[model samples]
Target: MVTDFIELGFAMESGREIPQFSRFEGPVQVITRGPVPAQALADLDRLLARLRGEAGIEINRAAPAATLVNASFNASDVPQNLIAVEFLPRRQMQAVVPNAACFVVPNVSNWSDFVANRRSSAIDWTRVVSRTQAAVFVPSDTTPQEIRDCLHEEIGQALGPLNDLFRLADSVFNDDNFQTTLTGFDMLLLRVWYAPELRSGMSKAEVQARLPTLFNRLNPSGRRPSNVDPGPTPRVWQQAVEQALASDGGLVERRAGATRALSLARAQGWRDNRLALSLMLNARLAPRDQGEAALDALLAAAELYRRAPGGEVHAAHIDMHLAVQALATGQAEMVLDLTARALPAAERSENAAFIASLGFLRAEALSLIGRTNEAERLRVDSFPAARYGFGTEAAARARMDEIARIGTAAQRLARL
Candidate 1:
């Protein structure tokens, strides 16, 4: 654990610096998209204070003032010269920052996925203090334990050194993403960044030359940084797996949950086929409210799964979603093309319940394009498998019959 900190320090001592993550020139203000719990906001405030407080003392750096901006924004009511930290929902994200990556909010994050299937996003952008806008968001669904850790990491990035070091175990900079508080090593890095000698716009060479002096002053005691836990902390992978498996929410909620799980998995650089498939399904079957955005997610996930090796099952599921989106959006040619690819994949899949879903999707797509006879045959073939998925043979048959008449699969599991 301590080695993680030592390694991070050594890397910083290396002769270069990330240019975009240069420090903020002024105080930052925290704005909530909703009425965030008071305690959560307070906890975040305390974490930011780490730059100048207890964490600072460990590295011999002075603490800074703790202040939160408590107003909503508009041209008229905007706070002057303070960076805004907005906490909002994912769909509402484009409002605060139009860049696709800024779309992360509590409960949902369209934070511009790293890739559709991989789901890992480039979070570094959020921390960069752009000359025009120095801002970030606090997702409303952020876990309580994570409030401090996230603030330190994101705000730390805002201060400078905007890149994440996946190698660090002693700091929140790594993608393990489970650390909930600032570490001593992180404080040292902050010390190196804010050292008076290292000015805001110092070139790499200038910073590199001065780092050794800062390092020595900060680590005169020669204590190595260690994770709060002696062992590696829990990983985000398990959290993603659990969310993928959970069946607690309705269709829209479940899909959103899957998207988040996929995002979490992607955030940690974890790669798993099951999580990818869950994400694909959720995006493919998105509720009406999501419309084209849902289709965008489906297309991205499909492309991601398509490129991944040994993901034939996931590919088939993606195709099925593609066909679903096509038919819903009235793209007849795409429906025909996507279903033709999806049919045999369903048959080849060894999972009976999944095969039933694919079969139902295929039949629906076929009927949408003036192929009634073929649609009925496939629909009938799907019933036995669909019964298992739908929980009763009668309900499954009713669903198929409804699809045949209405040419859509709106109520397949509406009971949920």
Candidate 2:
């Protein structure tokens, strides 16, 4: 646990004077003055008070780290602050503050701990990737590599064949391996196979010809889909869509198809909050009709969830989705309305990411409404420094770009 804290401290101190300490510019530094006693609550308090007095700050006993570090640096008032105290016995520390923020003792020493603590919850790869990117900021990149490899191994074990196919496509697309990678047409074919409605138009030969044009336009490397005719089969189209959706490669037309799928799903009964949120995301590359449909579905979902029992957070999620969708669709009024409804729910839920997302969404909405100062403030407030896991970096960067666009748009409006 102590080692973990040291590692965390080092992570926090990256590119700073302190080797493995938080870069807290504060007046008081209450040294532990000796080994921590097994039962020294009174002594700890006295030290805390003295430190607070020296720092000219009110002694907030409620603030776990107020006395240890200056009041300004206390991240949370949780008792876990004691974990930062070096040379303290693990047992003694545990005894002193069983539920304190002092130190987090990881269950296991290595990857085995993850396996032991594994839960049945759906994995959010975005969060995992974000954490991995943050770890890159650390001096030692070994931990990030281990985490990435472990996550990949675990995901490979957990996901189904379809998901595996999608992941492989993502890898090829991201790596820009288009010549050998799956093509946009291949992904389209996969969609046709999985989703029956998309195959309404044209024959197999026409699709094959269209596939190359779409692939050439979408792939970052500008390589067309293989001309080797897979013959006229619905399977070909399904393969193409599946490949395109999974691939990291960018195909404008493929993106349009994904948007259409989201819109179609929204038209169906699958317009749940999660699905609506996904559709809103898809709106970034979707056609106007698809984007509008997604935005409407997200709004309806938010309203539905809001009225349902025990659905406040779910409703908030929907509202956040709606706000994001509104921004993507250039619906200023809708963004403001949805954000106004979602902010309270986000606060009630106390979800930091949700709150951050709300702030970002609000910033975008405010910008659209010509509120430049407020938009900028919200953007800065919403910027998250360290996300929990991997894949989150790309999402975070994208969100940041959205925030920047809002700011830029607001500036442009001001000029007008």
Candidate 3:
């Protein structure tokens, strides 16, 4: 646990740069730009409240107060110690980083500064001595759930850790993206991050020396008789996973990368969450005709997650895939069973999109069983989340129509 904590705080994502401890020394003030949705505004406020109550970080929601004219153009001003969260159009965000959902950067107060200094050392998280201002970019045109996910991650980064660790099963700090909201572990990390013993620019050695005493004080019960380090993630495996998931990769390259990642995980003798993730990715990137293969991989990943600690959410995510397969195969009972088991976990994790998807699937399953009224109720109940999760009424309706078509086809097949 100590090792994970230190690595999370000290390590940079690049894996080559020297570790530099950086964090905010003062209260965090946030201002938003663009057409920031009301849900986003509400979610940000809730997140700030959590930071205050759970992580003990001082933060407040601040509206845009002043217009500052810069050398090039005029924009809403963000003062020092403030984070300017700009909600860009989805296309504009994609132009910034293809397939990027959202991101945060240190030492920049607004979007312009972020773009200007993004390539320079000015935005490099490793070099910062103390955080004064930062910028968070989110896509305005995305779902409500996406908005909240981005807020949780980007704001957490703005105030705390800069790197995401794969080993963490229970944190939004993991690249797995399974845990959409901040978990208990994430809050603990932030609590320790703002603890009086640490500060910006501290070296790894300095922080390491202090962590034993610190953890004993903050989380004394977390100590175990035997501590196992899962060890560093192999760079080759990391690269393979990235290539497999990254949007820029061609289909052939992505499939090859997934295969390589799975092979590496096997060679490493890892039966942990990393192995499960590799399996899940392999399943996700599998070709449409390879449905059986995809199901097999997903089932394996689901089993792995079922046995591991902090793996409920991982299993729930896999269940979504499993439910889709069940729906496709005309296994209505299986779809209900899978979704019923998964929904609680998804809801607990505050994964709005997952909740919405599962809800729609469950409704279809009910209708297939001749439960029309119940199915209607379920579908109606799911509407708000669907609108938020799918981002628009048309998108939600399309998903419903698609699910309905699958059910109809399944019924047709059963008759044939």
lDDT of each: 0.49, 0.38, 0.83
lDDT of 2 by residue, 1-416 (tens): 11111222122111121121121121212222124332233433543453243322222333433324211122233232121222233354345445321222111111222233335222222112111100000011222222222222221111101112111212211111111222232333222222212122223343344444443443436443443321211233234444335545566756755565554444444423323333434544456766566566555655644553334556667666556645765677787787788777656433445666677777777776778899787766665521311125675667668655754565465567
Prediction RMSDs, each to the true structure: 18.1, 22.8, 2.6
* Candidate 2 vs 3: which has more TM-score: 3
Considering only N, C-alpha and C atoms within 3 Å, which residue pairs clash in candidate 3?
Answer: none
What is the C-alpha lDDT profile of model 1 across 1-416, one tens digit per residue?
22333333323322233443254344444433344545566666565566666434221111222233343334444443344455555445545444332322211122222122123223333223332233555555443333334455555544444433432434455443323345566677776665566555544556566766667777777645544332322244334434544556466555655666666655645433434544565565567797677667666656655554324445666676566655555565676677667656445433445566656666766666668799789877777666544546676676566544434443233223
Please identify which of the two predictions, 1 or 3, would achieve the higher TM-score against the true structure. Answer: 3
lDDT ranking of the models = 3, 1, 2
Put down candidate 3 lDDT per residue, 1-416, tens digits, no spaces: 67877777776776755467878788878777777788888898899999999999888877545423232223344467877788878898777787678998877766677777768987877778888888888988888889999999989888888778776788898887889999888888899889999988888889888888888888898876765558788889988988888887899999999999999999998888889989998999999899788889998998999887678999988887788878877899999999999988998898766788888899888888899899999888888888887889998888778888888888888788
